[model samples]
Target: MDTLNSGSGKLVGLSFEMGPIRPPSEGGSYSLLIRVTRNCPWNQCTFCYGRPYDHEKFQMRSVDEVKADIDTAGLLCDEIKNVSWELGYNGDINTQVGTALIRRMPQLGNSHSFINVFNWLHSGARTAFLQDADTPIIPTPRLVEIIRYLREKFPSLERVTSYARAKTIFKKKEEDLKDLSCAGLTRLHIGLETGDDELLWKVKKGVTAEEHIVAGRKVMEAGMELSEYIMPGLGGRAMSRQHAENTARVLNAINPDFIRSRPFTPLPGTPLFDVYMNNELELLSPHECLEEMKILIAGLDVTSRICFDHFRNPSYLNAPGQLVHLLKQDYDGYKLPEEKGSLLEFIEKGLRIGEEKFLKTESYQL
Candidate 1:
């Protein structure tokens, strides 16, 4: 009997101890997602999808529900191991290896369901994703209990990460943040979307530029890794300079651990979508956005690692490791072979070209 086939009757959202979850972000990978929270607490960002069910109303998984999912994950792991061994595939190639592997093996299509479940269970999945948008809204004590429980279940837990709005962080006392950090809340992902105060107000980010800096600093001060998401074209055509300037100012103030550049792509149904529909918002084309990023990077004071580890970003510009390498040297040594010109020069050229093209083409294929 396929060990995977043995447990097909288990319920959805049930806990098992075998496989992994969640999609990878631009700069880093996602573990088997154990969604702790249900929906985004602050659903005001113009770009976010919020929860799969409701984008506006924030919700959270009950403590009981979270425990149940963890339980299910444990059981699933055992089944995956049994199946892998029975198939003469033991050791390295087991449920713990990941679902990506099982999917690649065409012979496992019938067994894919089991393999997938196993992947979710065993893939170094100690990281739990606090669901919804602003999981920081969860009460610190309660959140701590959840973290503690997960740690007890998986002692090797590397990080328990969540998303939060700047206002949410600002609202929480510094002590509370430190308490959460002490309780094993490892990192907080903030969508600083754009640091431009005017654009932030326009986008209804629910926090001022100063609040973003303060919140980021607090997270870092609390000894938690602060990962900020910076959207390139959030300012659009009118306030691009202000957007880059403001963002650089905020990042310089906090000097966050990770500055992940997420070039804005306005999906339909959001406020930005409405703006585009009404011909009110003139979005930056891919090339123009690169120019904007160049300006943003130029303005940043040398400090954290800047990452363009996402797909939507243009390669003509990159972090250039300037923060660490530049003050000692100058911009002369900051060239990435994948990029076209000097960061500033590339931006200027891209702006002059005006036409936008995706990075991939037959001529560009390696």
Candidate 2:
């Protein structure tokens, strides 16, 4: 890494690789990002079609390369702290420190890695997210070593998380999953999409409903918190009912820690988009989407927290013309069984508000 002197302190080049996307919850937490892989291992899901990665082929970084990135992150963290101290903030990272550093090095204003580290430190440096589509696909020992090295470098991290595929989790041996948990991987986010078998096949998710259940159960059993992402309106009009009820059935089976809602919107480059344009898949209206949410929530018997953390979750206009989200969009959403009635009531309120007042799924693309 090249070093530059700025008066009394020095700033390293601070460049490191980062992936395209991560969960919204991770973003909310300002988790330090570390990319272990390049893209989705199986990028054929009709709903997404790997557009997040610009349809790039997947590749796993070597352990050495990942460790180098971690080292660079640590070095950057130290440099930020040094700047804080030099600026008389007593080693604290705050807006003023960030502003001063950016003023000193204007190029860092455009550096994603620098901004990621700065925000992470400002947020207490407690959580980290491994990036790119699937992380567990890396060999077990290698993944474990990477996690251990990360923990070694940043002792303050309270949790480490990554995106994983149900099929990959299903294929992992029980011992491997346990080994990963032992290595400090605290959580996983798996895209369940929908539990209806037909819809799963149509989307080419590359995993069966049974595989999803097996994978979810394995992650929980391995002592890691499991977050299963369910896509509302993924079934379109034809399979909405099956999508809702069957998804509830699967969640009931695994009882994951978090059941997240990600309402589907056809992106321009996806096969699903083409199908929507060709008039083959009819998207549910706002009211119909809430009806589907009602079925799914009503059928769920899990103790998991159902969250609508995504921006695309259903929202409506209140009486005063102010926009209101139907459900709380927090990372720790309402607890189920205990708050099931409240959730259902919220759904009913959305329904009573009528379709015209609610934002339609067609109004946005993500």
Choose the strongest candidate by lDDT: 2
C-alpha lDDT score of every prediction, in listed order: 0.64, 0.91
Candidate 2, residue 286: Cα displacement in angstroms equals 0.8
Q: To one decimal, what is the Cα RMSD in angstroms of model 2 from the true structure? A: 2.6
Q: Which residue window of length 10 is worst by lDDT in model 2?
A: 1-10
The runs of at least 3 residues in candidate 2 whose Cα sits more than 4 Å from the true structure, single-residue gaps closed, are 1-12
Estimated TM-score for each candidate: 0.76, 0.96
Candidate 1 ranges with C-alpha deviation above 4 Å? 1-23, 26-30, 49-56, 85-117, 120-123, 315-366
lDDT of 1 by residue, 1-366 (tens): 233443333422234331122324411333445556656666667765442335645567677777776666556555455555655567344443344334434344444334444443455454555554566787888778877777787675677887778888988999999989998888888889888888988888889999998999999999998878898887788998899988989988988877776677666657776776688878776566666787788887745666655555553322442212111121122323222235566456555642433342112211
Error of 1 at 302 (Å): 3.9
Q: How much is 219 displaced in model 1, in angstroms?
A: 0.6
Give the per-residue lDDT of model 2 (tens digit) for 58-78: 999999999999999998888
For model 2, what is the alpha-carbon lDDT of residue 169? 96
Clashing pairs in 2: none
